[model samples]
Target chain A: MVKCGLEIHQQLATKKLFCECNSELSEEILYKFERVLRPTQSELGEIDRAALEESLKKRRFIYEVTPNSCLVEADEEPPHELNREALEIALKIALMLHAKIVDEIHVMRKIVIDGSNTSGFQRTALIAVDGYIDTFFGRVRIPTICLEEEAARKIEEKDGGVVYRLDRLGIPLVEISTSPDMKNGEQVKEVAERI
Target chain B: MDTLRSKHIYKVKILSPNMEVEPGDLVEVKTKKGTFRGILMPKHEFSDENIIVLKLDNGYNIGLIPEEIKCIKKGIRRKKKSLYKFEKKDLPQISIISTGGTIASYIDYKTGAVHPALTAEDLIFSAPEIEEEANIKAFVLFNILSEDMNPLYWIQLARKIKDELKESHGVVIPHGTDTMSYTSAALSFMFSKLSGPVILVGAQRSSDRPSSDAYMNLISAVRVAKSDLGEVAVVMHATTSDDHCFIHRGTRVRKMHTSRRDAFKSVNSQPLGEVRGNKVIFYEGYRKVEEDVELYDKLDEKVSLIYYYPGMSGELMTRMLEGMDGAIIMGTGLGHISNEMIPLLKDFIRDGGVVGMSSQCIHGRVNLNVYSTGRKLKKIGVIPLEDMLPEVAYVKLMWLLGNFERDEVIKLLPQNLRGEISARRMIIW
Candidate 1:
């Protein structure tokens, strides 16, 4: 038997998930800074596999920022409260899919050090889980739904460093995951469209 | 014991007196937003009050407000120890001189701070692959940021290199990228002829980071040191990949980027050679080793470099000319300064001040005969430095002033000294 799973990421039309910055891309750059990220040991006293892999490449990260970028986007300031508008839209989608919302929202860090995000790790929170959507062929179970921040858009790579625009960073994004229930490619498409 | 030196001492006083905490200790903190668990980090020397710093388990650092803290609990402490062991083998001897940069450093797990690796053992511990290629002998001349490096240090460094060449095949200098090119140019002039290669290497990132270019750069430097190349050069990453490193002439290279593994580029000329795998490939017209080495360690540092820009006043130019032995003007286009400063420059030249002009374009030769502004400036006695970089011209002027008379300096500023000026420009990408 063949098992398939789908993970979909969609951007939210609202303010950034972790800051008060506007969710828009800016063409003018105001400032730039460089940083070197290092991998840290986890709670289990072992480093995450992906974080360890990224730490090995040892490339310097350059961030091109605009006025829209707050101290949060530059990693100089701590993140603010989560965006309520983004959370409301995420809840609306969860209700539409008949997914059960969690009692408490906890932000977790997923390590990603490819210079895409100013912060070495991306912040994500599980909003809902365990829901079912009906398709023409069968029912596809939604295993998880998460709200996260979008990474910075890479502008160019040169001189042994990667440059990223801070305008796209911190924008809210919704991630929806589904368990394998489709028997054919047509059914998978139907399931994706239904969501 | 590492003490927490933050201004949030009032908050620490509020916490239970029974619990003792220090920087780098594992601790759990409870705040109004949530509970945070990680290693307690020392406060930044200039950080504001009412906030605590923590290095989270996921390797991300976060700042917590003191007002939201409910309680703090200390956790188990773990001490990390190095496990590197060196085995001596029969190989070419290479001397490494650590001059303080990311290339000679590793992150301290306890404080999350980077410290210079002083001894050969420390470098070998970080990059064990060096032991397989060469018999390493390391020394720490002085630990300072490259920006703080001066002509005195260059003289001392040249003398040290002369002494090290007696026992080693080559010498490697791990330097900070900010002023690596200036140091390279200074050394090229100081050492008239060398018995072996004197390679200067630097890293874009610290060695503790897995993606650091330190290992490959040091490897390439050692390899070049062991090769037949006999001139001073800067060995760094040629591309973003780990394939090879380009060996740029000491006086012809510049750090073109603020932060990048390949920040150093050969300006106005091609690289002297390239280090691929374990071998060095010399380009055409490369310098060869000679049996006898000559060293010139005198440099007059009373020279100034003025980078010309629009709307700049002549007062700044006048001040730079005051008590200056010589000056290098980085002019616009084909080496032309604004018309306003031309009269003051003429007076300065008449007062026995030696001045040379180089283009800020960083490429192409300076032709003072091209435009009217160039010709007018040339009449004022500003020597056009042909195809020489501004920093290199500055160093060359210092060397010339130290060793030659005022008239001789004017004559020597335009001549090619230690390959600072190319005979013919080559178009190579």
Candidate 2:
């Protein structure tokens, strides 16, 4: 039996997930800064394999900041409270999926050292769990719905370093993950569209 | 209260129980909102008296209102000071003259603030691998930030290098990247002849961070210093990787980007050479001269660099030209300025003021004969500085005015001195 699953990341049209800056891409850059990222041990006393792999490359990350980018997007200032609109959208998606909404939101740092996320990790918070979407073939189990900050958009990659625009960074992103319950690709597409 | 002093009076009253706790002390502040734990940071000068500042473990500083703070509990006391020691080896001697910048600094864990690692010992301890390459002698010339650097400091720094060269094979200056190119250009002109390399190095990130460029930059600089190179150059990251570094001529290099590790670029020319691993690969056609070194340390501080823009008034130009020995105009597109300023410029030049015109485009040569406005500028006695960077032109004009007469400066501003201008353009990346 063929089992299919889907993980969709959708950008929300609102302010950043953790700052008041607008969630819009900018082409006019004012300045830029460079950073080097290193992997840290996780709570399980082990480093994330993917983070370690990226760190092994030892590449420098250059962030091109525009006037639209705030201090938080540039990683110069601390993040403020989570975007309420983004959280509400995640809640609406959870309700549509027939999922149980979490009472308290706890933000987590997922190790991602690929020079994409300025903070070396993506801030993700689980909003809902255990929902199901029915399709023609069968029912697909929705494992989790998450709200997270998007990584900076890659502008150019060269031998010495990679340049990323901070305008896309910190933008609110909604992630929906489904279990491998769909019997075939057609069913998976149906469930994905339905969700 | 004794430690709190005259600031944050309202917070001081609330923090009476924890009066013994100093700024660097790790503390847990109990508030109605939550229990916040971090280092008790010194109050900012403009901070309100109603708030207490704390540096969180995540390296972020946050302010808490005194009224919201229920209680304060002090934690471990931070260490006051730590010393560094270095061992002299039998390797080639290199003098490290430290000027204030992130390259020669580390973050104080307690305060979460960057402080200069002022001694040679501190720098050596931070990058222990350098001890094997060179017998290092360090000197802390001044501790001011690179933004405060002036012509006088350049004179003093050049004199220090002249003195340090007597005892070492090369001199490595750890400087702030902000004004490093200027200092490097000044040094390039000050030393007429060089017996060894004088390298300026800086880090884009402080040593406290895991990604700091301090170690690699310092290593590359030391490698370049120990090589056969005998000129002033800025050694920095050639690429984003830690593989190698480029040696840029002091007079030709400029800080093109504010924050990139490879911010320093050799404009209108290729790098003098690239330092990879333990090898120095010099680019083709680079000059190799052997002569007794001469120092020209005098620089006239009256020279001004004006970057001309649209709609700029002649009064501003006249004000800047008044009493100035010389001025370098970074004119728009092929050395053209507003027509209104031509008469003012002519009056300034006719009154014995030396004026040189360089392009603000940064990559091309300035030609006053190409445009009508430019021709007008030339007719008004503006000397076109071909292919010279505006900053370099400014520094060169200052040096020329200090050492020579006005007539000599007019002749020398466009002359190819010390490889500041390339005779022909080469398009090798």
What is the TM-score of each predicted model, taking all chains together?
A: 0.70, 0.70
| Candidate 1 lDDT, A42-84, residue by residue in tens | 2213445565446555657778888779777876455788899
RMSD of each: 9.5, 9.4
Which residue pairs show backbone clashes in model 1? A55-B210, A56-B210, A56-B211, A57-B211, A58-B211, A58-B212
lDDT of 2 by residue, B1-429 (tens): 111122323345555453566666677776544566777776654556656776556444556654333235554433332323344656888888888787877444445344576555555545666767888777678776788899999999998888878867888999988899999999988888877789999987566544557878898899888876767999998865556889999999999876667788999999999988788889866555344557998999999899999989988999999899789999998998889999998888898888999988998899988789989988889999999999999999999999998888888889988889988887673
Q: Which ranges of candidate 1 are over 4 A from the true structure?
A: A1-195, B1-20, B30-36, B44-48, B56-60, B66-87, B110-122, B427-429
For candidate 2 chain B, which ten residues in a row score worst on lDDT? B1-10
Interface RMSD of 2: 9.1
lDDT (C-alpha) at residue A159 in model 2: 80
> What proportion of the real contacts between chains A and B does each prediction keep?
0.01, 0.07
Candidate 2, CAPRI quality class derived from DockQ: incorrect
Model 2 complex DockQ against the native: 0.09
How far off is each candidate at the interface, as Cα RMSD in Å? 9.3, 9.1
